[model samples]
Target: MSRKTLLRAGPLWQGGVSPYGLIEDPGAGGLALPAGFGGRVVARSGRKVAGLTWHAAPDGGACFPDGTGWIYVSNSALPLVGGASALRFRADGSIGDAYRILSGTELNRAGGATPWHTWLSCELGHRGRVFECDPYGTRAARPRLAMGRFKHEAAACDPDRQVVYLTEGERDGCFYRFRPGDWGDLTEGALEVLCASGGWEPVPSPAALLKGTRHQVRGARRFDGGDACHYTGGVCFFTTRGDGVLWAYDARTSALERVCDGVLAITSAPSGDLYVATREARVDVITPERAVAPFLRLDRPSGAELTGLAFAPGGGRLYFSARRGRTGGETFEVAGPFRGAWAR
Candidate 1:
């Protein structure tokens, strides 16, 4: 999606070496990566990076292109102190600045990046909501009440459909779709829940005044513990930890298929591989060919789960956060040739 070459859906490397050839020894940060790749702890909670303290319990994250470098925004899932923060990188990949983008939100967890470049940070409890924040930190974050109120996990914007698909984290959570009157405007939208028949029914009470949004729609399908979401190549991919299933919704056919098992946070690579941070302390890559393999493993010091997963602008660098690291929480960067690996 960043103007990089897309990995074909067919067999990769054609009797050649895989991009993830062989994992090298663990780095100083305890992350095992493939050869030609390196990892380092970029930031930690209770510590400062670029003069600003990194938020604790870093959960969901996304990367946006800046003038030459990029900005990485991560949501803090610590209750009552939850918010989202951003780190701006200079062209040389050094920290240019770090600041808060969305403050005062509670239990901010996984969210998706909008095609317009805004980050949709979702709150993670019964009273949760979606906050559209400017990744650049220039504009104040705005809460979109029209997106409905529920225990939200993540959101994925399908530019072609002009709709935003949201995942709920409840045990019996419902997959939701929001259709805005205008493409980029999220202020007013028709919130609908997905039905088992592939049809959508308007949410009787998006505010959930009478009951929970999931229950308001009589026939709305329930997803177990929906987690991270990502949209790419006409499909919307999401994960459910309750059942450990990775789901793919074909936008064109309006069909849902189970792609894999074991998931947490998910991000798509420019090469068409879906990198998923599992409930386990590792990240797996689901290639376009449907072959799944371990991409990276963390010798988690705090026995924490992997949460955030996002690729830098060119997809050469990957950024993810350990929900609870040695320093309470930590964000790590893995640099390799993931983007242009096919041509090697």
Candidate 2:
């Protein structure tokens, strides 16, 4: 099947305004053919400026159809305390109306959409939590305290096996899976933290002594609020920044195993392949056999911090967001030349 590659370019909005930096690589071309990619200013939020630490981060976004011929993106605007906003974009790259999903949450990072069409926004701070927001903007947002939230990063939902996988974004975070008591309705489900043993295990405190080896526990103290998905069968993966370890939560045996380390973000491809993004502006393909290799490296300079990664619907292309230098941000679309093939 032939894949369609549609590129939309515009300037990213910061501080409720357009920074309007150079979009294309000036050295590569005359900036006339749109050498790299252009970014469109979607929406701006400046009402509560006093509460925000910085301008709209717009860190992570996912593409989803919104009844009309447009796609909606749940953007993580504020870093730690500000809420996330949902913005719709047209096929022509025009920005649409913006809606507030959840407010007063900590560090709304990159979250994945549930199979049921709800957005699971994760907090990236020490007091992180997850909230489910309706894309239609008619439902009240609530936190799933049973999920044991603590500095969450991203979440992916399987929807087929009725399991929602979650990621913790801490120095030595743990991967978690929430098996809701009822799959039909997510609001009233029993949330269980992934455990190695049959019961709860204590997570060590920050001051706990650790000399050489790492300790694996069954359960940590529940945060009464965390970010997660209500979708079923989603793969649960988490990243630990200190050692750069990625762990996959096993649903069948309730055990966490090392899947991939030295990566920043993990997203499952439509072909069941896992794509891991590193902070070094490179992405790797992790295979079923646990082999790791490079897929693509951004052509930008070294200061480009690759923050968010998401696969376009149908898995034809991969998209990543990067903040280059001090004030510029760009999203790159890599054409999938090799289908079902993992790269470096």
Candidate 3:
């Protein structure tokens, strides 16, 4: 008895535009889609362009296999001049061709996508760093710095154990796992900083009690943000906002489990299931024993804030991203079959 799909509230573009990007709903029951659904912007951010402002801070977006559309802006506050840029959208959403990649690094925001496809860009700034572009934009993008560069916010890869799952966008954040030893090669890794020794029950603070403490960020560092995914057995989830916990770094025994608390932005479900986005705008579904509940409920207008999330491979559809006051952002599409259905 698992079948309840109904989510359709399309087209709503206010002054700030709104919608960061999210996907899921290639067809049947995963349901979710918003972020240029059919496209048609071609390109934007006019005016002399220093970093192409409208305030600039578009934050994480991806969709390709041939559909083409990639976005990642940053300049919420930095040396600006490409503190973090990378835009390319054309499925009609317009805006194409803009690649600075990573500059002085300050706000970069949500980034992840690497089964070897490259594009890890993170930097929420306090001392954040995590760059690895190459989605065809040539090369020259550095900073793995052994992976301990702080403030980074979303990264996940595990091509059968190549391993990489990092998220720390501070408010007391820490949850990492990098095992390059020779796996898929991210230079040559062995960076592990996750430590929640026993099973569960921690959450005291100091960044969720720093799970097991083995951290390392001497010298160069900035913003240890959050937002990550790579579920199922190899496990590698992420999300942190002082108390919105949802860690889970287990590449087998690297350990760091906080399972699911509050949640803020996580994506998965080609059947793997695990879609969370909640500052309370809702969107939850964790279960497999962990238990969560509510699946989708977004009306937003009051304060408005819903970061990125994706899952559009061949399921019901679920994609998200939005921002409303502080600088006003945009990206939306929501069509789902959401509301609890897990029994595997």
**lDDT string, candidate 2, 1-344, tens digits:** 12111111232121121111222343321111122332222332333322332225555556565553334454454655556655454443444555666777756766777777777777776555667777667787777654444666677765556756666654444445556677634554433344435343333321123420013353442222222222222335555556665555444444545544466666656545566677666666654434455555565545565555655555544555565543345544454343543330
lDDT of 1 by residue, 1-344 (tens): 63221233443332233458766778787898888888888899889999999989899999998988899999999887798999998877788999999988888989989989999999987769999999998999999989999999999999988999999999999999999999899999899999988999999788887799998878889899888888888888888979988888888788888766777778888777778887778887766655667788898564878877998887888999987742378899888778443211
**Model 1, C-alpha of 212: deviation from truth (Å):** 0.7
Best by lDDT: 1
Poorest stretch of ten by lDDT in candidate 3 = 1-10
As a TM-score, model 3 comes out at: 0.28
Candidate 1 at 216: error in angstroms?
A: 0.9
What residue pairs clash in candidate 1, if any at all? Answer: none
For candidate 1, which ten residues in a row score worst on lDDT?
Answer: 3-12
Which ranges of candidate 2 are over 4 A from the true structure? 1-55, 68-81, 91-100, 136-140, 146-149, 196-235, 253-256, 287-292, 324-328, 335-344
Give the residue spans of candidate 1 off by over 4 A. 2-18, 325-327, 341-344
Worst 10 residues of 2 by lDDT: 1-10
- Please give, for residues 194-219, the per-residue lDDT of candidate 3 as tens digits: 44342222112222234322233322
Instruction: Tally clashes: model 3.
Output: 57
Higher TM-score: candidate 1 or 3? 1
Each candidate structure's TM-score, on Cα atoms with residue i matched to residue i, is 0.93, 0.64, 0.28
Candidate 2: RMSD to truth: 10.7
